[model samples]
Target: MDVWPSLREAAARVDDLVAALPAPGARSAAQRAELGTARDAARTLRVRYLDAHAEMLYERLTAGTQGLRLEELVEAAGAGYPSVVPTAAQLESDRGRRQADKEGHEIDQGIFLSAVLRSPSAGPHLLDTMLRPTPRALELLPEFTRTGVLRTRSVLLERRDGAAYLTLCRDDCLNAEDEAQVDDMETAVDLALLDPRVEVGVVRGGEMSHPRYRGRRVFSAGINLKCLEAGDITLTGFLLRRELGYIHKLVRGVLTDRPGSWHSRTVEKPWIAAVDTFAIGGGAQLLLVFDHVLAAADAYVSLPAAREGIVPGAANFRLGRHTGPRISRQVILHGRRIHAAEPDARLVLDEVVEPGAMDAAIAAAVERLRSPAVVANRRMLNTAEESQDEFRRYMSEFALQQALRLYGEDVIAKAGRFAGRSG
Candidate 1:
């Protein structure tokens, strides 16, 4: 569909300005300065263009969700870090990136997501699509129910008698999230919710292979810093996808377009999080949505967003509900670590167990929350606590906040340093 004439003009201008700017590399000192100036000019033009043309841009883009889902279209429009460069190709030399250039483009797409998520007409449809069970999950669900286990790149889904366990399986990185893990994790989540026999859901960490913690289960270390250093993580793909995808599904559940599904309620399951050694950053954010949490005595959790110079997913809005405002501030901004056994951490960790007994404790906790009322109560709880409107508002703002941080000079410099140390 053709867009408004003004919007088309603005978009054309945007393209011309972007085409004039140099690509990511700037070799000489003079070239670096020139690159910075050109990029700044592009940003100025884009933001002003957005201010003048956001609505038409949104309408023009969303008009095609019939062909591409809103999520898919944003990705098609360059919403994240550049696609993964092959390992051998990357070994040659430094990328020398001062900031995430893709983010300048992602800013516009991010705003579209934020806008769609909050629009009364678009929001509901976006929610349905965003929370829809992934294509992979749909493909694997039938086999999953019969076999009782479903595995993905970053998650292990095991269906016991009544509970479906969604275990993070990125053990090589201590269950840290990376670019590929989002879909894997979300697909596993979809199966758990759709499985006819699953009464409740449980998420825990798989055993780690790191020499220091070999064979020991370690709940997530959050976003993979190694991947970040490698420039693999992106604003839309890794960051916003988690918020709108699996994490949201953990609380809001999945919806589908099957016959009668519109009248049928969302297929939500009450979830239990079993924190083993620790839940850091993204891991800690997961805790906020679970109906119950079981943590080992030695387990700790933290959201080191301030230290990492990025937003901590939904923690800024949701952690306060668990830890209260003061402690939430400490956790998000002051880099405070809250061990499972601590008093301040009590609210987030429902029950603490001995490290070796996490499995048994999780089973018991699942049984306790396994009644048919669990999902119903979860919906009720969400209504009173973190309503849809509230979540929508936070995410809408977060979409842009996170994109800014992903491209911040400090964050880029930090990633380069981390890469330097590792290399």
Candidate 2:
């Protein structure tokens, strides 16, 4: 029997079937399922062909290196839909089966290669060939990226069970400048809150500054607003921008003049804001204005501004009202990190999650806040006799002092030391 002609005919039949299916966006459930089966078959056929051609074209394809750095190409590929990613055991078992099936072939390249063909480059080319993301998985990507600087190069993605998933780049170790990028990122999140479509907002943990720690460069301890600056005093001047001034006006628009914008509401969409991973120092304080707080089980939320020889900006007054005199005194006086379990803790973190459980925690928190019962009656009860007056005073001083404190030599040095990135 002429096997080559038979193989070529079979390959042509498979390609025809693949081409006739509806596009990813339009595929019906049954069509999608059939496509999945066909894709698996096509992948196997590809590996068989490649192995057959290897004797003549192998070196050219691999460029003198080990079998075409498939792993590197997979690393570069963009996200697909989130599927139920298999555990290591499942992948191992699947690989074994493929290897056994290919053992009788002329050359057994590997089962992994037979299972999928991840493109060496990323773009529409890959999307057309690979399985499409489930609608839910596609929804998460834009929501996650809309609020911060998700370095496209660092996005980690996986696909399984007809879905796609994404996480920060695996090698996403933070440097000082990266942390500074987060500060700008949070500001972007704050701006996005003005949009009604957004239900939750976040700026994931990242390096704020690049300073030499003991001996190596590291991300600094707090949000680094330095990147927004143009000159020596530029970061200090960021607050004076009309855009920032608009934030102030928006807050003032609702609650005349409230310290930290706490107890204020915008005419825009309602939202539940959250921060994870070392939401202390400036990071913690910045979040104080949010309507709700969701933290990680291991998250360290605090305010250490006082340790640098300054009070807790307007946070002292706003947070004092939120948690009362005792807890506020503890935070302001000691300049300590507030673990989620502290009694009468300021900001009253609504929920806590274990390390790596931020997504689940965020989902639960957002879902709860979306309920009419939760959003209508805020948990706070104001008691200060001169609440409005005091809040106004604090906002004014907060503006002036925050400007000075952020750029002060002492604060910068402390931030550098904390981030392990020396200024």
Candidate 3:
């Protein structure tokens, strides 16, 4: 069959099904499963069509927003959901809900995200906008001295002993990454880097509530797959936002408007990751970016996003630096887990402490990382490892690739399986 006709038909099926579904809320478990299958086909066609006409659509969508900074560009799109979205998405309730929910419109957002990065002028402008602290960060900065604690929905930042303890607090899902965590983590990191009292930053996960790992601190379980199943994780809100947001800030340091490259004139600090039980998928990706890592003796790390049909953040780009190409491929492609105290994790783990000794380990690690040369050499090492331009290029492609993977059949199927097993 011809591509246009098939694409149109596929989209029609989704619209028809969505219109017929109950409006009180989302579909039932079974209905959602049905929708999942249909959405997969529809997304595949739409993504292909979008890719084919990316240039034409990109020019029109970004015309008014051209030359605008990243923050300004989104505001220009619209106050909220309507702006930057396609006519087709605008005409439907699901589209409106998706935009409102901050989980839909990945196809357009993907293209727009890529266009912004690929543009010669807007690229740096976009990077500058994202690399800086969020407005929330500024708001919380004042409170830092009062409590030396800045708390967000999914993250907690505490300033003490000259170290900013940046704790990931999502015990409900073993500290998995969701949109909320992504936003809050960025804010916390900003507060840490901004604080004059903080000489170093320490990242570690909170205690888990799940019975299987009850009370144990898990580094992270990666993207909230259950949320992924519910279609809650969005390309713009989570995936793309993260690579450029906190994760980059963690590696690049919090940036502000300056005359020179973002790398220089920095407020950056060395960070140490205290890996607890495990750092799976996105968690594992985080290990590659830290200046130092202290993994629990029993802790292990793995990149299993590919198994779920999703990109595991920047792990693909930076893992090779820590684990070589062969090891990176094994972990990323084959879902290999590198346990601490083993040869595989030796390069990544600065030290592997017993689970009970984590606090002492972190305290010592903080002091070692606070050496003046650390702050002095952080920017140099980060730039040498992955320059802003190199990252921009990676993100330019990742925007499109991850958008498709986020909505792929395999992702949906795996999410369903996870939900079922949990249920």
Candidate 4:
């Protein structure tokens, strides 16, 4: 079927609706109506594209790429399609039923997630990607082999005594992550996880060098709302980059020991989080995956995503494991703030140390966790706790819900009000 023409027409309708809106932050009933219309058109466009591409991907996966090279497959699929064609090496590496399973699983995830975002179906697709044994090729890939220091503006990576310290350093905004910072953090985590010199990894927020912060450390204030308010980052962009690209990568790395790809080997190292001050929104969400959490006495954690009208990445899936279903619902649905001093905070935080002694506490914890026995135990625990199928299911739902809420007129209006208050 010739779907491109319909896609183009839908795009044009969306463009027309957008062009009718007033300037950013200038809210009006007319502008709200225009945005709602644009959102509807965008969703329709997304559904059309996803449906067509889903069929194409399924065919490609099932038909075995017809022995075509990766670039050739891309050419065959034609332009304006999804750009997730597997590499020649990836295709060649698959052998027999394993090949079908690998390719089919990847394609299924891609299409299932696409459909979820385009529509609202929470049911899981039947795929054995999670239940199957790890592929031999993936197992053979080097786990941790970094040869040199990794540098980044937003994160500081230091290796000492078989542990790598990854400190979030954007204290000027209390380590609030913008797109670049998110990219930097992801890179830092990857480097630390892959470095053979590192056996365990620790993530913490750095003490602010800015005068206003008075040398205090902050875990994170969450996504850079200022950038969002300035229209520098669209809600879709933030969801894709910060949520899917950044935090999701970290969560996958921690839980499955694998990076965000199916082809990568799992890193065997355990990760620890040291939270100081407050971990708000995405910050608290990040802590949910850590094997151990050490928080300062003054620190408090919150998932204010409900208030902000966004989904906290992976928190819904993993937070329940730590905080139980009821409290997880309360923290997420009711926007409850959890202070380190609260008994419920113990569900998430392993320890709460004196505010000024977090460094010493983390140091001791790190030293104690350096034993081979501890590593083995941690790995066993991780194997028991992590579920790839569950993670994939939660993420699909999150992507859909987050997109709807983030782009909805009500949420945009709420964000604008927040921007006004902050300004």
Give the best candidate by TM-score: 1
lDDT of each: 0.73, 0.39, 0.75, 0.61
Encode model 3's per-residue lDDT on 1-423: one tens digit a residue: 335677667767766776687752455878877866886786666556544553454345457542443434544443332323333333333433322232244665575567667665556667766777888889878888668987776888889989999888888788889888988988888888888789999999998888788888998988887777766776767887788888888887877654664556557889999999999888988888888899899999888866787888778889888878998888888888888978878877888889899999898888888888887787778878888888888888898788777666677788767755541
Of candidate 3, the 10-residue stretch with the lowest lDDT total is 94-103
Expressed as tens digits, the lDDT of each residue in 1-423 for candidate 1 is: 223344445555445543565654424557557555654554454445544444444455557454345446564433321221112122112233334433244555565566656565555556556777777789998899899998777888888887888888887778878868887888888888888799888888989888777898888988877677566676666887788888889888887666766644688888898888889989999999888888999989998888788899999989998878899988898999998788877878888889888778877888788787777777988879987777877887887788777767788777666545421
3 against 4, candidate with superior lDDT = 3
Alpha-carbon shift of residue 352 in model 4 (angstroms) = 1.1
lDDT by residue for model 4 (1-423), tens = 656676666655654554565543465777767765654564565556666565455344336422322223233443324223323343333323211122221331233344533332222221212211123213322432433444568887777778888889996788887767865765666566555577778899999876666588888988676655444443333454455443544444422444464743445567789998899988998898777899998899999877777677678878998988999999999999999998999999999999878889888888877777865676566558865455555655665566455445555555666655531
RMSD of 2: 24.9
What is candidate 2's lDDT per residue for 289-337, written digit by digit as tens?
5555666665567776666544443567666656778877777778766
Say which prediction, candidate 1 or candidate 3, comes out ahead on TM-score. Answer: 1
TM-score of 1: 0.85
Q: List the residue pairs that clash in candidate 3.
A: 77-83
Would you estimate the TM-scores of all the predictions? Answer: 0.85, 0.44, 0.80, 0.71
Give the better candidate number (2 or 4) by lDDT. Answer: 4
The segments of candidate 2 whose C-alpha lies over 4 angstroms from its true place after superposition are: 1-187, 194-196, 200-203, 206-220, 223-236, 239-266, 344-347, 372-390, 402-423
Question: Each prediction's Cα RMSD?
Answer: 5.1, 24.9, 5.7, 10.2
